[model samples]
Target: MNAFKSKTEFAQTSVFKLPHSFLNFDNFVSVMTRAHLDRAYWNTLLIIVAAVIGNVALGTMVAYVLGRFEFRLKKLIMGTYIALSFVPMITTQVATFTVVKNLHLYNTLWAAIVLNLGTSVLQLFIYLQFLRNIPRELDEAAMMEGASLFRIYRTIIFPLLTPATATIIIIKTINIYNDMFTPYLYMPAQKLTVVSTSLMNFSSERSTEWEMMSAAILMIMVPIIVLYLFFQKYVFAGIVNGAVK
Candidate 1:
């Protein structure tokens, strides 16, 4: 309702009078044109594609190794991941920022992509769970057919992991779309703004354009809501399959 309302009317209208507020599309037009949301949308799409691909590849490889092969340091490596997950991200910002600067990733879209590339512990566990259900007989049969480990993974394992991959893609896309801190902190260039930060056009330290902000919020929300509604079954299936055995 506020998205269609004039600023003055939005500010003065009573909560009970919301249904009677004037409908105006000026807020939507202003946010879309003046706020430069188009560029942010494209930038976010690039980051999401890169980040999700990296995550799926890296997570699958790690899960393949840990699930299929026996290694001396396997427990230690997993323990490290679990331990690090407990550390609050805010507590490590200084070190993380310095590393990003050292690698010269700061202020670039690569910074967001690289930072988000690594698989989280939860992702690792989910992938591992799926790997566990895959039969060793399949690997053995592939090996008998002169298939290398890489071939087995690419043609055999990857195809079977599609459900889990879909779940991860949906979840990761939503996360990257909604994330503001990474882009705001590392990529401060006005041209690098993402959808999460584009709403700042309606905000100032002194006061905010509530009507425009409402419209912007709606714009930002629709994609994620639609995405989840379409793919929610995969998410539930992945979680249940990963947890059951």
Candidate 2:
């Protein structure tokens, strides 16, 4: 009966064998087909798009003001933004819930977009610094040629700023794509999820399914990586934009 008792103890141990859950290609396809890709992946793409557009537009404008023109309170305003950059992100997490609720944006795709769209102080500062590197002589020449401010910006300033803008867009896209917490708090409802939050759900329902998780994570990561790879040159130029001249 010793052998029988040995088997009984083995079965009773924490390491006791249980039915293995196998993940094969068929299971993967089934999961992929069933997974809510639209709610998460597409929503993330939309948010990233909105954030980049808004940031690029507003950031360029702010950079123009700070870099090209001068006025009262300019230093104060720019300094305030720079100071705000130091405030830890954790401090805002608890407060944004109420603001988001008042705005009635929670659990919506707009919630993600709106939350992400505001000017990033760092991006603004980077763009502003880059703008400073652009020679004022270019603007003077444009004005001498009777070029309008808008035309000058469109033809000269904007083109010259391409390196910074592309780099900023790429950086912002990766940032928004990877940002999970803001969406988690502001878009708590599963119906309007993004990749970051969806990844969590994918993890929960398929905790034992690493292959699927790996695939899902890879899917979320690959596009951003590819974008950065494609624009690697601009990324370098952006980094060096203000270093010379």
Best TM-score goes to which candidate?
Answer: 1
Clashing pairs in 1: 4-24
Q: What is the per-residue lDDT of model 1 for residues 1-245, given as tens digits with 9 covering 90 to 100?
A: 77877867777886345635355667788998977989989999999999999999998988888888998999998999899999998899999999999999999999999999988887777788888888999999999999999999999888888888998898789889999999999999988999999988889999988878989999889988998999999999888877754
Where does model 2 exceed 4 Å of error? 1-24, 144-151, 205-208, 242-245
Regions more than 4 Å wrong, model 1: 19-23
TM-score of each: 0.96, 0.79
Candidate 2 has an lDDT of: 0.71
